[model samples]
Target: MATTTGEARAGTAQPASLQLPGIVLGVGLGGFVDGILLHQLLQWHHMLTSTNQDHIGVKYYNPKTVSGLEMNTVWDGIFHTVCWIAVLLGLAILYSRVTHSRRRVWTSRVLWGWVLVGWGLFNLVEGVLDHHILGIHHVYAGEGQVWWDIGFLVLGALLVAGGYLLQRSGRPFDPSAPTRREARRA
Candidate 1:
């Protein structure tokens, strides 16, 4: 007897707690992508790309000059460290919460959806704070910079919406229950 989607939710763990770990993980991982892809790989911008005009009294660290490159590199390292900490914290939270077959949780759409939510949240927050409010850095930091920044926020919004829908369509994870494959086998 194959269990229906509704049956999967019967023994699910607390949804609130279940959603957290993935979100934290998503935030950290998303930061890594942004940092590695935009800042390092492409060399499009740096930590303090336009900070000189941010109205925060932050001096611009031009990525071209030796001293500027050093300062920017230091700030980038700090950003990466923060992302790493978030990932560690996420893992710790997941470990403490899941007592049974963590395999189920690992395969859960709900958790992954929450991760998407977290990533989207990161983009929205970062885009607003860094690109819009503080003017620390834009996505491209050149002509059509506003478009690039807006596009980032748009993508974030899409991720949040898409993830929410995907999770809603999924069955809840029941750790102790037989997996779908197992149920089908029997």
Candidate 2:
């Protein structure tokens, strides 16, 4: 028997376990972690912390003032809402893909690894945009804030590198491959 080109490609394709759900979860959960730890718990900054009186020209929120705090709180709520949606969307994608597939989809390392990549992507993008581009806020808003901001970028890079390595280590799922038990019986 000969395999068609489509079949050949399918046999070598990366597993779905490494894609949708993990990336979605990574972005959403990553956002939550940042928001919860930095914004709420540590009081490091808020969604619009640096927007007020800055070059952003919004002046919508200021962490130093009561009105600013209220505005920032609302923006934070909006950010959380977006993150929730990302999570829900990811779950939906994962469910749809898994349910429609004939192959077994376990919680593989590829999934976890891609998730870390997604998270790192989130961190890198968000950190660069909010902290550097828009000047919204820094990881730490006191003296030598640049150092903290740089650290955030470094962490993001590390996560991305680590995740990529982990993902690479995983073997692609071959639909035609025999299971260990099946092979043993042959």
Candidate 3:
């Protein structure tokens, strides 16, 4: 008998722990995108991009100064390292969840939605703490950069909303249902 969505949920429903892997993956991947696009490709900003003006401890991020730029580059490297670790950890968790756990939530919509939520969360928290509160860096890192920072937050919010909606829409998904590939394997 083909399993209905209802039966799948009841028979092999994903527990709370199942969501962890997807969320972690999302956060890590999101960080990579930000670091690569903003830090490298766009060259719009860097870790501590505008910290010099804050007069904080050892301001070392003046783009005009070679030393300052070097300092910023070092910090950016550190940030990227952390992001890389997150991605690795997430992958480990996901692998364990899929291989060991009997109940797998493979619903594409649900997984992607949670991932989006995770990414949005990363953006919001990172933006608020690093950009606004800590005064470490801004998105544009120049005069009147608040607007750019705000825009980043706005984008994060939108991702969060979209992800949330997608997740809700997939509430009835049945991950236990065998796909054609699984049938072929069997």
Candidate 4:
């Protein structure tokens, strides 16, 4: 296909490496917001906690079985550390692949989709396992918490769908574009 001047300039001027790093950075920042602001800094809830129950009858269960399950700051810190690790990993992947001397290595659709899917998966899994099953935390214990969690999941699905559309829109990486050495070689 013949390249227009504008297209040529855009292709040549902007490097994929530069664009991808920001997206990865965004993922890290978002993770921080969730782990720090929502989970730890606010102390709104913990990853695991016994559900509140009201009972007038005498306790049937042994005290030892239930005593060890209380919320602790140490566990919260560990969860936050894991979140930071995930963000760093995402950043590393984006930096290595997108910033390499390759043309169109980072597609907008794919990158956005990745972020959405990843974020969504994190929420869905965490919600199901921690909030619903283990009773470690409720999906939204605080005001507007449920809405935020739902929004995160929905946004993730949308991103994945948007990425699929972008991929199908006949916008494959042009491996023969001479301006980029990697593209020219392919």
Candidate 5:
């Protein structure tokens, strides 16, 4: 008679761990889009500069130094580089999984879903803090900016929720349960 231990054998495959790099990448991508398009490309406003200005007796002078422009660009570039690194790391994890021929697991999906959830949460929190609490910027800088920002939050939430649902559905991809086909042949 053959005996088997309760625990899985050493050669047994394990599910992949949650991918942190991917999560970071997703968050970084969102931040990059916001900073690049909103702050830099479109020139809506400078992120690091203060809107408030003080006036001197002889001449109206802003607190910001002339070097603020260069500083802003450098800051933006650094932010972009960090984001890109996150993206690349995420891609590396995903690609390694693909190359290894491992079965897809619910945990992997859940991990990715959480990343989206985290990103959405970050956006909502930062939006409220910066626009409402700190008054650094108006919620709606232009005619429709508020709507757009709200939409972005909503979309982020949906991505998270949808990914969770996909992982939980548990439908069989192969359409063959381990025993069903054998029973049919017998």
Candidate 6:
């Protein structure tokens, strides 16, 4: 089939997997944000805070006590480990999708946009399952905690929509071609 220069360029770009890699990466990184910001820094809630009713056989631990804090920390470590694994997996998938050098794809809006979507998705899934369904932990906890949970979901939805728009507008990356800097030297 005859192809225009743009079509040819786009065709050679070896279409980026816009969603999977970024979302997976975003989910992992987002988990870090939750773990670091909410769980550790702020000392708001832990993995098993509201699990008394959620899991009948689960042991309840109060965050204020040293013993309870130790258990929560352990659970947080487990959560972080899962997030780290996710990041590694995401990177592997992203590496497989790129046809040429990663220069273009790494810097492209599409990747970052999908990342935002992924982060948001993480919030939605975690918020729904842990916060709402299982009653594990709340974003703020205490008065008006539901609002905070709802806000988390809202932010996730916004990220997905915004990321979709940004990803759509991104130019098809052709990393096999020389970057502008390399082109200038040529």
Best by TM-score: 1
lDDT score, candidate 4, position 106: 46
The RMSD of every model to the true structure, in order and in angstroms, is 3.9, 5.2, 4.2, 8.7, 9.8, 4.1
Candidates in descending lDDT order: 6, 1, 2, 3, 5, 4
Model 5, residue pairs in steric clash: none
Cα lDDT for residue 102, candidate 2: 25
lDDT of 3 by residue, 55-122 (tens): 35546568668997788888889988988888798778766655331344554567778789878888
Error of model 6, residue 102, in angstroms: 1.0
Q: What does the lDDT come to for candidate 5?
A: 0.50
lDDT of 6 by residue, 1-186 (tens): 133336745755445565788899999988999999999898888898766656344688877889988998899999999999999999998887764557668778878888888888899999998888888788988899999999999988998899878876676554345565666787
The TM-score ranking, best first, is 1, 6, 2, 3, 4, 5
lDDT of each: 0.80, 0.75, 0.75, 0.50, 0.50, 0.81
Better of 1 and 6 by TM-score: 1
Model 2 root mean square deviation, Cα atoms: 5.2
Q: Write model 1 residue lDDT over 1-186, tens digit each, in one string.
A: 134556545653334565788789889988888899999999877779888778577888887899999998999899999999989998899878775557778777878887888888888888889899989888898889999999999989987887777666766654445556666787
C-alpha displacement of 9 in model 6, angstroms?
15
In candidate 2, what are the lDDT values of residues 1-186, reduced to their tens digit?
033435544774444554767788788988999989999999999988876534577665667789988889888899999889988987777666653222444545566677888789889999898888888778888798889989988988888889878766665543344566556787
Please give the lDDT score for candidate 2. Answer: 0.75
User: Which pairs of residues have clashing backbones in candidate 4?
Assistant: 17-99, 48-136, 49-136
Worst 10 residues of 3 by lDDT: 98-107
Q: How many backbone clashes does candidate 6 have?
A: 0
